[model samples]
Target: MFFIMTISNRKKQYIETVEKNITKITQYTIFNRTFRHNDRKFHKFLVEPDLNVLVVGIGNGDLLASLNPAVGVGIDISQKMVEFAAKKYQSLNFIHHDIDNKIDILKHPIVGKQKFDVVILSDQIGLCDDIQKTFENIQALCHSNTRLIISYYTKHWEWLLKLAEAVGLKVKQPEQNLLSTTDIEKIAELSGFEVIRKEYRQFIPFPLLGLDIVFNKFFGTLPGFRRLCLRTYVVARPHQTHEKKPYSATVVIPCRNEKGNIESAIKRLPQFCDNIEIIYVEGHSKDGTWEEVLRVKEAYPDLNIKAFQQTGKGKADAVHLAFSKATGDVFMILDADLTVPPEQLPKFYQVISSGQGDFVNGTRLIYPMEDQAMRFLNFLANKTFSWLFSYLLSQRFTDTLCGTKVFLGSDYKRIMKQREFFGDFDPFGDFELIFGASKLNMKVVEVPIRYQARSYGETQISRFRHGVILLRMVVHAYKKLKFSV
Candidate 1:
């Protein structure tokens, strides 16, 4: 039919256009140099050494090689580009195909039928004829835990880019789709993907040494400044199906001079799983908190309880010791003061067991707190730290100081293995788990909980002293997580 022929002709024309522009751009060194720099920036966020990566627009194969994924697969519409990539990087598999069209991705022998851990669309979404269909096609290559990373230029930079092209600093290209961050998000939603985080970066594309570091690393992450950045990135994943199986849990209570609340905590904690293991890591309490823990363990003979006296000084050390002794599929941290209710533990457990998120953090900022639950200055500090950490980690977190955090036992072990990177700096054990979960590319979900006034002895935290410690950790995280890559 004529309609079928017209559709075939359009496909041929689109492919020809892409191939011609791609082949032409190969001759420009300045253009390629700029792209190489952009590739490195994307590499820092998308690629981890242990992941399996599938890059949709693998132009020169530099991005794929930079990632160093265990299993790397690259695909492109241009046969010339595919040939160049295949010959240059003999280790990685390069295929000549149009991602806009639906194809059996499992047909490839090298990639096999297994789903990839990360699926990347590196500045190529703009060239697709049907962006939603393009995203839908790649669903076959993803698992529930897979992260889809998309990077593209903001429309605000369109004029500047054209000027660069006019001056021969950049390569000329055919007109492509110009999509804003919100537009791309909507397309992704229609394609069965949910956006987890959105970030803007690269205020200065040219390397200017100290100036570059200050602008991109420090000032670029700021609120109003980040909106003007050249590049925008969205991290998304497939909508997961909830699992209906029961899981065991371990609630770790790192108590340090909370003798009055020990028995109350044990009694009020709800049983949500097949088995609930309670671990008490009593720090060098000036009060008789360790003795109280031992007494409670003997009195509550029906409950699964274990107690340990921490040899180390800080709460982080106590948690590290307790986690080592924990025996459960789900690991959790509950403050002994009972600020966040023990009954809320079931909500955290349900989130992880249902495949909702890998790291579930409790947020106290959403609900109204009890009278005198937190000091005015302390509340202000929590708000300030939340914004700083959300920017630092590229994930939205409202209450970073909340002590109730939960994750799988397997993930906790992996985090402990990489703890040397951050060192023994976190006294509260909050940032250790948060930064670890972010580094592993895990889904982080925040659950709102009521904050109650402490019924025990005086608070152990020194407001000014711990505040200084938190600021130091932020700078340390900036160096290790933001700039190190």
Candidate 2:
């Protein structure tokens, strides 16, 4: 009986001490970059600006403050943590609120008519009794492009955590309704959302403080670490593609010459996948390209093909013009050259449905290309840029300029607002897509497919001049996304 009473007292003390330490986490913000990296890979790569946001946990989040949010909201069940954080970052909005109580997310005035650009729920998923309801409510709380970055501890960390609780250094709250990474993905996907990025990290961020970095890192890096890691960070966004109510997609194909492949391309492309509308933005072509596009449109009236002529002569210019005319939940870029087949578009569609990634890109490197498809000099540049971008963007992209990319329409809006950041210089539309996708923290995944050299037309990408321009983009991204962020 005496031992039981002692254990109960220790548990109480553990909660109290954790509440105190959390209140003063500004001291740990220096170490928080590593924390952010472990949560979102590209965040540490510094390709993104600090995200301005709110966290529904104990204390004001210094991590959010570092991002220069227009307003930051930090809430916690404990008044002690709220009070401490209030004094720390008094410039930002900090609220003392109990997450344990019933939350009518829609009823909240801050999100009633207005939703946050980003919302965070860190280290407090287990405190809420209704896990599904909590997320469903959070779903209601978000605008279309709103990003939610959440971190949580799982059952696998329970033993070590309980020991820390006994030592009065940690708190083990009751398992209200614990969930796995896959569980959360399913919940989000079913609720018109998808996991943009999911990471299992830091069994213990503070090695000397808790489990020690060695054992923590080992388990954290393990396969399915979500099965054992002390924490998980999941970034979810609205998956624009769904069956409940079919949404529209604008497939923009920019072609300059390449009449040889037009007939095959039109025939091979997916006719209808869920309200897909095909638009051909034909640039100035020396060949009979306009005639071919017209013939194809006449052949397939059911495809909803609209052919538009652009006065400008660049890929980015063509894309921009077509995008202004697009009215869809999703957008796609299909090169008129048809190096990558249109048949593979369903795979890109599947990527959106899977919720594993947000931006779908065609990767020609994974599959062998036809003879003379990529010249040696161009191949060298491709390899160099692939490595450079993977490091610069914190996302793996096997092909940087494959002429095929897709993303949600809402994300496009977010990118459009930040378009001035990367003026109108990208002729191939590669840098623009990559830069914007990384900025929004969208997970960019490669969809491997075969590549055939262009069947017609000369390549507009100058071997030397454009190569230098491309190189400059890389250096600029390093300065903007990497070092600055």
Candidate 3:
């Protein structure tokens, strides 16, 4: 009985301290407008519009309102903060609940027993009484596909933040738990979440016209500098329960001039799935590749095979056309050159069917390549772009130019709908899929494969021209993805 009483007293004291700090900050924000810029930066990178969001530690509901979630609910422990938020943002629902204690989120009238697409802890995880318990409570509001986005300050900036607070540059922070990224990841794992992507941002919070753009947009994302950034963001999802379910696979082979390898490519493909569909998208091949595809389809009568002559130029157009007609649950791309072997298709299928990753890409850099498979200049270019794209997408990729890529059919349709945003610049088709997968917040996984030299014909790629095109695409991505509002 004494221990229970002491626990209750501690809870009461913690709540009172948080309440006092929140009240003081609310007053401070009303007078000082620049303080809210920090929240705006967090909103810019993390929050997307039209999601069903439940923001914990939603102070004044500003960040929650800014996201424009279709179903928005903001929660805070302080009643005064809830009241203020309710009045300021009349459209959003505000709840006054202590997250540390056991509370049924579904039972809340405003939330209406609905599962949210996104559950955001924001900067409030530091203030929670039990971080693991808080995450456990959040699990009730999530489904398998639900994403949890967390933003917190790096412990490196603790002294600088304290100085800012003392000098009246920032709001007075309450006594809170300072957590590192690894610490948060452990807590998330213990509470049934899997970390997907991690990023660091905001080298300078104060806005300057040209300098802020250069520092935050370019310099802050660099390797060594990013570690010292003021904020850290992590994207995670619930640990999924996998079941044995049969999935159909479609292999899209984009061919331009590989006539000699067509029959071998068809014969070498292993029967790995319950149902396999082979699609030959012949891109106006001058070497009778389309005729060879038709002959192969007729010869392999037992196999489900379809052939199409692409009316448009480039591999991207061919992929888009083939994907539009694809019927299988899993969509895969295999270059007709047979650089990455058809035998490796099973590994891609297993990754997707077992729920390991939503988008699986082939990596040629890991395993040794066959003699004359890739030139020295090409290898160096691949390495350079891989680093650039890894930073741009916040996902690590060793070989982004690998033609072998796999994803779901439904996701392909969604990506096709938004393809106009990036334009028809990607002739290779690899970046389009990679960029789209990253934009949709899909888990990207890479499988290493041996790169083989093509025996049928000469390579179609022009090194210098394609390198310039890739650089242009990167700049476009920066504007569309990194610098966007």
Candidate 4:
């Protein structure tokens, strides 16, 4: 009985010693150690704007200051750490709360609401005796939108980490984790968060017995190459966004006088496109384009429908007005003339869903088109532009003037922000998406959709008048993105 009592007592003391060592490291080593300038490693860990933030293991408060000014609070079990951070960033809120002492991070006012845009564990996670429990407490503070940034000592550093511990120097490490990259991921998921990005920095993040500080400086700039990348930095968010079922797309058809075509276009659209809401932008025209769109929308109430007028005369202007009303993960433009049919829109949707490319474009020239639809002169112009663009972009651009185009709405917003760089020159809107796609480096997938000529209403394109403008826009794109810095 005495022998068992002795062993139990020793084990308890041993655990206490490890806990004390961690608290000391949490307060001093992370915050007190600073470079001539701020540590670039810590600064790079901050990837997003911290509109509202919480520092889970607020060691030295160094990480908090580097981020965008945010309403933030920091908590550390160690009183010394709370005092240190308070003294440094007087503007910040620092309080002492032990992770193991029934003090969940989520219970804190700033965290409980999960209102933070970013929640940082930083090197603070290294000091925990129970890394998984600490991770769960941090996870509750993250909403579906929050970004959690964390890093910890790799298990491969066990020898050096033990040496640091022996010398009474603060060693930040995962709790006896022998942690591999996969281990980190499992723990994050168990804690109700999903790892979004995992980046390995370098093999050796610190100065070794043989390698000099100069080698460390060189590895820092190499960004790509390195051996002992110390710890992996994980950027994780809640997996709920990936789990939500995708919604069907909104297809916008801009109609002028294509009356004979509407009923067929409505029927031929694929079954997956059943939930597709078709909004027709009807510009003022002599034919009953408005009445025809109303007829199609009535036939398919399963497709939520809205029709509006385009005061401006161009297709580009019509797309701009139609898009203001679109709500879909995928936004597609279909010409009402059936040059590009509604059936082809499903392939575009599938291309995006399969993650083959962000933007799907229709290529009319891939297979020969109906001869009557494209006149001999228009054919020559299309061929010339296709060859020129393919050469310029170093990608197979089979057709540059095809009216049908498809893309994700979010990516479009990014491209649109800089649209003024290429002034609104193309009335067709084909070059605008092409130019934006080239600028964004978006993988452009050309789906071969059959093109048939309009059986009614005159073709809107003015070949001779638009040809000079198309040539000028290509020159402009070359100067702005390709040849310039």
lDDT of 3 at 278: 90
Candidate 3 is scored at a TM of 0.90
lDDT of 1 at 151: 85
List the candidates ranked by TM-score, beginning with the highest.
1, 3, 2, 4
Highest lDDT scorer = 1
Worst 10 residues of 4 by lDDT: 1-10
* Model 3, global lDDT: 0.81
Clashing pairs in 2: 46-481, 47-481, 207-213
Q: Give the TM-score of candidate 4.
A: 0.51
Q: Looking at candidate 2, what is the lDDT of residue 250?
A: 86
The estimated TM-scores of all candidates read 0.91, 0.66, 0.90, 0.51
Which has the higher TM-score value, candidate number 1 or candidate number 3? 1
**Model 2 TM:** 0.66
What stretches of model 2 exceed 4 Å from their correct place? 1-53, 57-72, 80-117, 121-146, 150-245, 295-302, 353-356, 423-425
For residues 82-146, what per-residue lDDT tens digits would candidate 2 score against the true structure? 66677777886665444333243334555345467677777666555555566666666576657
Which pairs, if any, clash in model 3? none
Residue range with the least summed lDDT across 10 consecutive positions in model 3: 1-10
The total number of steric clashes, by the backbone 3 Å criterion, in model 2 comes to 3
Give the candidates in order of lDDT, highest first: 1, 3, 2, 4
Task: Please give, for residues 291-372, the per-residue lDDT of candidate 3 as tens digits.
Answer: 9999999998999999998899999888888988899999999998999999999999888888888899999999888999
lDDT of each: 0.82, 0.67, 0.81, 0.65
Error of 4 at 63 (Å): 21
Provide the global lDDT of candidate 1 against the true structure. Answer: 0.82
